[model samples]
Target: MNFKEHIRVIEDFPQQGIRFKDITTLLKNGQMYKAAIDELREKVKHLEIDLIAGPEARGFVVGAPLAYALDVGFIPIRKSGKLPGETIEADYNLEYGKDKLAMHKDAILPGQKVLIADDLLATGGTIQTSIDLIKQLGGEVIGSAFMIELMSLNGRDKLPSELEIITLMQY
Candidate 1:
């Protein structure tokens, strides 16, 4: 579906020398949104995914639907203090600074296979922290998924070698 075309590019957004790939435009178009998710679903269908863990905000948008399509449970990896229960947290570096991500302590069970999802993979910090949280709780991260990847940033290099990374579009 050429999902990249649906993404809006904004220059120097939230900082200088940075190009932001906005997904709002893609989400506005119902058909394209569904098609994009369907494509992601197809890629992960063969994996024995026990749960889908999506980082806060945009990740929830695609992750929720993907979990439903795959008939697996969805776990929210939120910003610190966002989740109400006892949680496990991981600190990571951001483009500008450091941030922390939290997930419910009971979100993942031991030996369960998890797939991490997000709208984009830029620096790989957020997703990497997500993988750490899952591991701390004894869940194994089988793979990671993204709608868009800034290949120039080389985010994939930071991820573990055992994990499979799937991205629908690359920029």
Candidate 2:
């Protein structure tokens, strides 16, 4: 569907020398957004996904809809202190420093299959940390899906070799 056309690339966004692929443009278009979720659902439907886990903010936009399409539960992975009740957190390295993501302790049942979803994969730190949280809960990370991938950053390299990674757009 030439999904790339729906994306808006902003140069030096949030910082200089960095190009950010913004999905808000695509998301605002109702038809395009549904098509994207359907496409992503098609890509991962065969994985027998038991749950869709997405990191905070943008992750919710992608994962929640995909989980609904797939008829599975959606787990929210948030910043530390964002979630109430018992939670487990994993620390990750950001471009400038370290940050932590937390998920409810009971978010995933033992040995259940999980698919990690997010808007962008830049350095793989966030997704990698997400994988740790899933594994710590005894959930198997079968794959990951993203709306965009910055290939030059080699974000996929940081992910486990056996994990199936899918992206709708790359730049």
Candidate 3:
């Protein structure tokens, strides 16, 4: 569907020499957003996913809808203290700085299959930390998905060698 056309790229955003690919352009267009989620659904439908987990903020936008389309429950992986119940957290580095993400202790059943989804895959720190939290809860990370991937960042290098990754577009 040529999803790239709907993305907005800004040069030197959030820092010098950094180009940020913003998905809000695509998100504002309902048709395009649905198409992207539908496409992602097609790509991961074959997997036996018990729940869709995503980090706070942008991840919620992409993950919730995809989870609905996939007919699975959505587990929010939020920043520390954002969740109400007892939660487990994993620290990670961001392109701009460092942060920690938390997930509810009871979010995943033991050995449940999970697929992590997010708006962007930049340094892999967020997803990697998410993987750590999920594993700590005894959930098996079946795969990870993203709306955009920055190839130059080599984010995939930080992830497990066997974990499957899917991205709708690359920059």
Q: What local distance difference test score does each model get?
A: 0.93, 0.94, 0.95
Residues 18-137, model 1: lDDT tens digits: 888999999999999999999999999989999999999999998999999999999999999999999989899876579899999999889999999999998889989999999999
Clashing pairs in 3: none
Residues 1-171 of candidate 3 have per-residue lDDT tens digits of 899999999999989988889899999999999999999999999999999998998999999999999999999999999999999988899988899999999999999999999999989999999999999999999999999999889998889998999999988
Tens-place lDDT digits, model 2, residues 18-136: 77788999999999999999999999999989999999989999999999999999999999999987999989986545899999999999999999999999899999999999999
Residues forming the 10-long window of minimal summed lDDT in candidate 2: 90-99
- Deviation in angstroms for 32 in model 2? 0.6
TM-score of each: 0.98, 0.97, 0.98
Displacement of the residue 131 alpha carbon in candidate 3, Å:
0.3
Better of 1 and 2 by TM-score: 1
Please list the residue runs of candidate 3 whose C-alpha ends up more than 4 Å from where it truly belongs after superposition.
none
